[model samples]
Target: MAIHKLDIGEFDEIDYSLIAIHTSLEDYRLAYFINQKLHVNLNKSKKEIQITVKEGEAHFSRFHYYEMKKDVSWDLIQNKNEVIQQQNENNQSLFSNVNIEVATKVYMLPEFKKVDYFLKIENSENDLNIVKLQNTLNTIDNIATIYLVDTNKIKSKNNLIF
Candidate 1:
């Protein structure tokens, strides 16, 4: 991103997005980063980064990430759910006062009766508060029973297994 001073006789400011040149890292994956640094290697990339998209290719350190908001974080997450808790801390984005967590929580719900991928949220400015309550939840995906909870009040119950 960039900022510029407007020069139409009066002093003003303008902001711009600076696009980074998509480049190849051309390096080996640091095992330490994947392990200790919480970096996930989905697969072995032939190159560190790929500017061009391809089929069945793994671009190293590439994350299909999401940003979790404060309301949703409090609503959905339970205490000490390890994967979510860690992601909430490390990969949080800073736009609003939200805990932007990242994790791929794939579930097999018999009630919802399907498989689904759980990406926390897209961005901070987003407002997505509708979650399917398991007992009353109805979805074609059948595995989409994500609920909103009252953590402090200890209101907890769901049909599916975590």
Candidate 2:
């Protein structure tokens, strides 16, 4: 695979509180490649750039990425709260017995204290659900920017620009 280098200028404006990367390859491969190419050491431990690789995706976070994931349980807590909030605000059922769950993993870059998150929504067909997930996740403190990357696009383009 061809390696694409990201420009330093591009990162100047980025806030590392929360970010996401979608890649075609496994999270480990992407993280390893990024570390090698960018000359940065990102590891799962040390809280520098907490890296989590799962199911061909990865996340980077400045804090305990996995701990946060554990804390945000999509199946039981977060989704339930979102559903209740949505229903109360709309005064009607939006999901209507449908399971609304969002699967997300986070990653971070210690050098910049920036984070990247991987999001997968169970009801991806519903645009409203997607928006709600994004909005809810954004509420997490210290999150400055969010980047949604399509792995297929990255594979075809041979680079991750942002």
Candidate 3:
């Protein structure tokens, strides 16, 4: 098997679109080969990028990894409570109080490139749910989100600070 190298940026996140092979290649062999060459680790979650080496198809994909770039404003984060308050202010029925927790300072959106592991589930943002929140944030740049480490309901987290 021959390996080709591409110009992967220092912080560029990987997605399926980065896969360049257009031909119908054997997926298993392809994945194994890529995994062997790339030293791709397999036992990661949907929140991790790895080559999925299966029966007949070998492929690399973002799978479940989330990448966040740091460019967040202090105003957005410090005033998060206010923002939530304002957002939930009008729609008392929707964004109103439920449960909110503050993570450690490190979990707060970083000012530079890094991974955030905690979240302070906002009182108002609970209705949309974490999965929905993740889907919504995926479209925006600079501002990106991930699932809470464990709890599904109130664990929405922004990976990057923006």
**Model number with the top TM-score:** 2
**Which lDDT tens digits does candidate 2 get at residues 59-108?**
23221222232232111000000111112232357645554345443322
Tens digit per residue, CA lDDT, model 3, 65-126: 12223221111111111011112243367656645542322222222224322222222222
Q: Give the candidates in order of TM-score, highest first.
A: 2, 3, 1
lDDT of 1 by residue, 1-162 (tens): 899877675522211111111112221222222222322232332323222211222222222222232322211111111123222344445654556555433222112222122212212233432332222223212223334322222222221111
Off by over 4 Å in 2: 1-115, 156-162
lDDT of 2 at 113: 23
Please state the error at residue 100 of candidate 3 in Å: 41
All candidates: TM-score:
0.18, 0.25, 0.20
For model 1, state the Cα shift of residue 122 in Å: 9.4
lDDT winner: 2
Model 2 residue 140 lDDT score: 41
Clashes of each: 3, 12, 12
Report residue 138 deviation for candidate 3 (angstroms): 1.0
Q: Once superposed on the true structure, which residue ranges of model 3 sit more than 4 Å away at CA?
A: 1-119, 124-126, 143-145, 151-162
Please identify model 1 stretches exceeding 4 Å from their true place: 1-64, 67-126, 131-138, 154-162
